[model samples]
Each structure stands twice: as C-alpha cells, then as structure tokens.
Target: MRAKLLIGRHARLPARLLLLAILLGSGPAGASSQPPRRFEDPLCHVVEWRTPPERIVSLSPSLTEILFAIGCDTTQVVGATRFCNFPPEARDVPRVGGIVDPSLEAVLLRKPDLVLVTRGNPLEFIESLVRLGIPVYGVETRGRLARILATIAEVGAVTGRETHARRLIERLQATLQDVRQRTATLAPERRPRVFFGELEGAHWTAGPGSYVHGLIEAAGGENIGSVAPSAWSPLSLETIIERDPEVYWGTFGEEGEAAARERVLSTLRNAAAWSQTSLGRRPRLFLAHADVLQRPGPRVIELLPELARYLHPELWSRDGQ
Candidate 1:
C-alpha cells in the first residue's frame, strides 16, 4: 500500500532542486568510493533497497511512531512490539513481542522488506535478521530531539519518501523553536526545581544527557538530577533531601492514585531525611505516562504545556477570574 502524505508539493522542491543542480554539473565518481562514517548511516553493514519497502517491521516504539509520522501505508507494517501504541492505529498491527525478548520467528513469518530497530535491541536478533538477507536499519537516537529528526530523514531516504520526511523535520524544528521563544521571558529564579523517578530500588532520575532533562528545561523547569553524567542515575536519599526540589514527577498512571501514592510513600519512607525537608512535607507530585515522559517524539510538544502548567500555574490561567 502507498503511504499517506500530508506535506504538499512545495515540500518536494528542495530535494528535486538539488538533483537538478547535480545533473546540470557532473556527478562525482569519488563519492561512491568513500567508506561509511560512524555517524553516517545507510551504512556499509546494511543493504539499502532501490525501491521502497512494501512491508516494514519496527522493534522499538519510538521508531514505530516515527514510521507512522512519515505516513504508514497498508501492506507496509506487518508487525510491531507491544509497546508501540502511539497514534492509536498501531494497535491494529500484529504484536510480535516486547523489549529485550523479541519474537524472531514472528518477524520472519511477516516477511517484511525492512526492519527498523534501535541500538538497545539485542545483537543476536539483529544478526540473525541480517544473515537471513533482511534489511535491518539500526537507529541510535542518543536521547536528543535533533537525533530524532535526523533518524526520520534517514528513514525517509531509505523508504523513498524523502520529501515527506524533510517537511516533517522542518515543522518539528519550527515548533521547538517557537516553544523556546515563548519561554524566553522566564528568569532563572522562575524555573522550578523538579525531581523525577521511582521510590523503589535505586531512586532513578534523568540526568544531564537524558531527553527528559532537556524536556524539563524546555518546559521551564530545572531537573534537580541533571548534574549526573549518565542519562538516568541512582541518587542517595541524603542527596535528595539536601537538594529538596520544588516539584516531584513520576510514571504512575496505570497503577491509579492509590498505587501512585504507595510508590511515592515507599520513596519517602526510604528517604527518611526527606521527611524533614519542606518538599517532602507536602510534595507537589504529578503523575505522567512513561512513554510520554520517556519517548523523544511528537508527544513532547503535548507534554510541554502540561509541564509548564505544573511549573508555573500563574502563567497558564483560566480565561477570567
């Protein structure tokens, strides 16, 4: 089936213009001889299709979402993991498996022309698919919004839909820029200090390089745990008590309010010192979906306003008193 594209004729111009210019001049014969660079994809390890892939399979939810954004067509996607539930239409696709343990047999049976998976996926599964002569494209997002757009462009090139992909990338960039401008008036002091994670185990929170930390900053909040080197890290209860963030955030919706409360209590219980701190006394905790909070995709824009409201309720007010 053909993919549906919302981007119109104008979006197709840039790539066409470049091709015309290349033809008018002369094509570089040396360009084909260059070895594939680390960051450069359509890499030597993977085989690229001359024609668009009619059947596709996605291993990760984020990749699946990107595919749909490019406009998934019928006969295109035969299988996806249980976690790829964005855009709602993805639910209709067959569920092959989940993270860590993917169903290789199910993937093979679907006979997809191309399979998209990210770096975190199991090496063995990817190797097996490669051995079977299936085109497996591996995307490494590195938890940044820019990388997400880049991946979309790459996928578009691979699937012969570069025009649609370029437009989508530009629109996403413009939206992000607009948000930045809207929040430019914010002062450093106005930025609320926020902590996010589970109370159980090591008390994980997003750090400096994490996409969530970037989102927190973009939404006008300061992530209390953004100092760590890793994207997600474990923090001590004493450290949390010392920092004493103004707002608390976590993934607790599926469990409901009672369960959420229990989870928060478990963390507070572990951090007994936090009880003495002001933030602990009457914690301004909020629950959000794990995917929305974690996935670095289009839903980030939707989450921004929700975060802004929590960070600065005064700015986001009702129409009248």
Candidate 2:
C-alpha cells in the first residue's frame, strides 16, 4: 500500500514559530547590565558573561535554527553558514563558511562575542577558535532525541531564552508520548520492517543508537538497520537484500518536496537492484522533510506527528488525530 500523504498538512508554521518580531524585535531582555554569570559548553569550556551575547556566530545549521527558534535572530545572530537558510531570515545573516572549513577571518569580521557549534565539529577547529580568544560553546547534536532537547535547553540558557526552550521541549516530549502511547499496543504483524536513509548508492542506514532508529520504532515500525554497527553506517547491498526491508523511508530537501519526491521515485524505479525488494514491489516510499526530520533542531517537533501518521495511518488518521 502507498504510504499516507501527510506532507502538505504541516506546511503551515505553528503560531509559536511566528512570534519572532513580537518577541525579539526590541532585542534581548536588556540584561547586559547584570553581573557576569557562569556558562559552559558540552566541551566544558567556561565563559563568564554579564548578559546574553549580543553578537553570535553559529557554525552549524542545527545551532542556527535553534537560535532563531528561541527568539534570537538577526540582531543577535550575526553570522551563520550558507546551509543555515531557514525562517526566511537566516539567509540575510553573513556567511562564515561551513562547519569544518569555516573561515575564521570571516567570523572575526563579525566581531562575535560568542560562537556556537556542535559536538560533531572538529576538535582542532574548535581549539583554533579558542586559541584566538574567541569564546565558543558546543552543544550535543548527533545523538538521540534527549540530546536534542538538552541542546535546545543549553542554547536557550546561553541565549537567555530558557522559557522558550522549555516550551519547545514540552511540545516535543508530549508528541513523542502521544505517538508512542497510541501505537504501543499494535500487534506484531502490524509493525512493518523499514529501511531509512541512503547516500551515494549505499545505505547510510540508521542503527540502534540513532535518533532516526528510535523515531521509526516510536512510530510503530521495526527499523531494519538495528543490526548495523553504529548510529549511521553504510550497509552492504547484500545485507540489505538479505534483511529485506518492506518499506523505504527517505528525507527530501528544501527543493520543492514534490519534485524531490518524484526524483527519488524515478531513481528507485530505474534501478534494477531496488526492484528486487518488497519496497519496490509494494511501492511504499515514505518521504520526510529533511530539515525537520534529519536536523536535530527545534523545528523537529513540526514533523513528529506527521512521521507517526505516515507509518501507521490506521492509528493516527487525520480526523481522528
């Protein structure tokens, strides 16, 4: 059966996402006068700040999105990578190269008092920034959902948006609970075997410890990549054929979702090897919003329910939900 088409339903941003101008238009809470307070990153680097940072640079797209989500935007977020395009305003921010090859010179030009990065960033690169006396904060981003929430709280604390962070966390946890509670009683036969993620003609599959692995399970589907070695691994084609995933779930980018979906379908249809699987015969292609589904950012809450519905429309039907 064709996977449920629930993409367009979530196209509209929730009211909370539209509070940027109202919440941050006047700028940070004017706490600059407060005495310096202690702050630290996941890497354990401490910096005493008198107030929320006025000028900040984000080295990763996930960090950039989190900053914008918690009412911190252009005025406070002075620089970001080219990939940080979201909320339609991040594009206006100056570019500081990429996570691995970020231009330190470009970052210095922004005169940022704080720079945000992820644990996935190169240690040497982070050290280089620190050696120049640039204060850096690195948050956890490459793990499970709990780590994502913790990162949001950390970003909010450092940016003085702790309240917004808590709200976002509550929503995510609620959605997670709702999905799991609703799907927990499914019969064994109801949970389909699924394969998620493919890159460069190989399976960059999600394994046991990964966020995507947990996501598929929470939505009541058995992840076929559970036996793979790590969170993300390129499984051999022979192993994929042996395991035989019935459903194929993939993520599409900002490029109009329709066109991207068709491209993926066409590629799979044209490939002979794909035609051998149950996914090819059944034609159950589950497409996910790449930014929301893959990026460990605040926007992920937008895709949570949609993903659950796609996997088990019987339990999460539109009107019923």
What C-alpha lDDT do the candidate models reach, one value each?
0.71, 0.78
Q: Model 2, stretches more than 4 Å misplaced?
A: 1-35, 267-272
1-321 in candidate 2: lDDT tens per residue? 011112112224655323432333344643454445446554666555766789999998888988888888799999998888887899999998987788889999999999898865678888888888988888878887677888888888887788988988898888889988988998868998888888237778889888888888888888889889999898887777777778888888768678877886776677777777787677677887787666788666556567778878888564575
* Candidate with maximal lDDT: 2
Residues 18-108, model 1: lDDT tens digits = 5544543354532553322111233234434435788999888877777888887545877899988886898888987986788999898
What TM-score does candidate 1 reach?
0.79
Model 1's number of clashes is: 0
What residue pairs are clashing in model 1?
none
TM-score of 2: 0.83
Candidate 2 pairs with clashing backbones: none
User: How large is the C-alpha RMSD of every model relative to the true structure?
Assistant: 7.8, 12.3
* lDDT of model 2, residue 81: 89
